[model samples]
Target: MKKIDNMTVTQIKEYVVTRQKEEYPNLIPMLKEDHRAAVKKIGQNLEKKTAARDQEVQRIEKMKSIESGYYDQGILNIGGIDEVGRGPLAGPVVTCVIILKPDSSRLYVNDSKKVAKKNRETLCEQLLEDAVDYAIGQVDCDVIDNLNILNATKKAMTDSLAKLSIKPDLLLIDALHIDTDIPQKAIVHGDATSYAIAAASIVAKVYRDNLMQIYHEEYPEYGFDHNMGYGTAEHIKALKKYGPTPIHRKSFIQNLGLK
Candidate 1:
């Protein structure tokens, strides 16, 4: 092995990358005092990253604990329900029912609003792949305008549950009760507190975001790719200039005075 004093900085970095996690602490000690500063900076950065990752893992475990007592009682298929696009002025409200395996990775799971878009997309893919059972339902803007957003959201949620391949023994839903026979607990901001609900929220957000991207191609003036059909200034400007599309929720947009 080359002595630390003889190794170039690039070589030392390569050595650090190859070292096992347990070997990191001892690595700095092996370096000469003159060579230690740059290497020490690298070690500090690694330590900080590890600490952040560990903290997130602990949070995920805490969130999963909500299902532990139920699992102990033999309720194995616990689906979480959540929806996206309820507030959007156009496009469909999308709901997801997801039964995440107890052992599925929960790192970075949280309310969809709290996650970055790129991370949400990545987590959505992971959750879908890792889920034991999952389904999605969509209600178009026409239904949202007629039934009203709250009732439309409930219908979408119920539809998602109906489409699940495996019937859930119980449901943990985010802040709304669906019209279903299954036993359920409505948790306010559940996506932020429950692992399963957060997973559902992430999946629903990504699914709706992708839909909006497609809508953007059809209606480039509305900027759906970025606004996701929300009534942003750009969207409102487009509404005033060009009028509502088939996807616009007429009931919600009446206040905007768009003819």
Candidate 2:
């Protein structure tokens, strides 16, 4: 085998990329004491990346434990209920009810707020595709203005639950109780603690963000693509300068003094 000292920098990088922890033992012996700086830097990065991945796996297992407790109780179909856009100044409140298979091993699943925007879309697709049953419900700004955000959010969650083809034995909801005869446990920060609720949060966040992106095409002044109708400085500035769009929640902006 060629020594790392004799290998080109490009070759060293390739080796680092392709190598795994099992090969790390061999790597140490191959490195020369004085000239191992480049290899050491790259190896450190690889180690850090591996460590982060392992940490995420452990966290996912902890989150999955919530569902496992239900599975232990003979509840096969457990649904996760979560909603997005409740605090946004505009756009609709979107909710998702999703039932994932008990044996799901998707490491990327986590609280939607913890995920980057691009990764959320990819994870959303993966979650939907792998789910045993999933459904989305959206309540527009008009309904929010009429019914109030909390009641409208509950409405959206219940609507999504109703749309699911396979009714769940139990619901793990994030913070709010839905008006449903079906059994549910309203968990504070369920999106961070429960795997099922986190999956639903991701789906709901992505779906609402997409809708806001579409709305951005019509109202580019508000920067909906990035802010997702949230009350950001830019959005508020736009609301003051350009006035409210049709999608703006009248009740939400009434205090803002935007007509």
Clashing pairs in 1: none
Clashing residue pairs for model 2? none
**Candidate 2 segments whose C-alpha is farther than 4 A from its true place:** 1-9, 20-35
Candidate 1 error regions (>4 Å): 1-6, 20-35
TM accuracy, model 2 = 0.89
What total of clashing residue pairs does each candidate reach?
0, 0
Local distance difference test scores for all models:
0.87, 0.88
Q: Report the Cα lDDT for residue 229, model 1.
A: 92
Per-prediction CA RMSD (Å): 2.1, 2.5
Residue range 1-259, candidate 2, lDDT tens digits = 4467777768888876677667765664454342668766765666677678889889889999989998998997999999999999999999999999898868878889999988998998888887999999999999999999999999999899889899999999988987888899989999999999999999999888889989999999999999999999999999999999999999999999975
How accurate locally is residue 104 in candidate 2, as Cα lDDT from 0 to 100?
A: 81
- Model 1, span 1-259: residue lDDT tens: 3456777678878887787766655664565243568866765676776678779989988888888778888888999899999898899999999997777865899999999999999899899888999999899988998899999999999999889889999999998887889999999989999989999999999999999999999999999999999989989999999999999999989999963
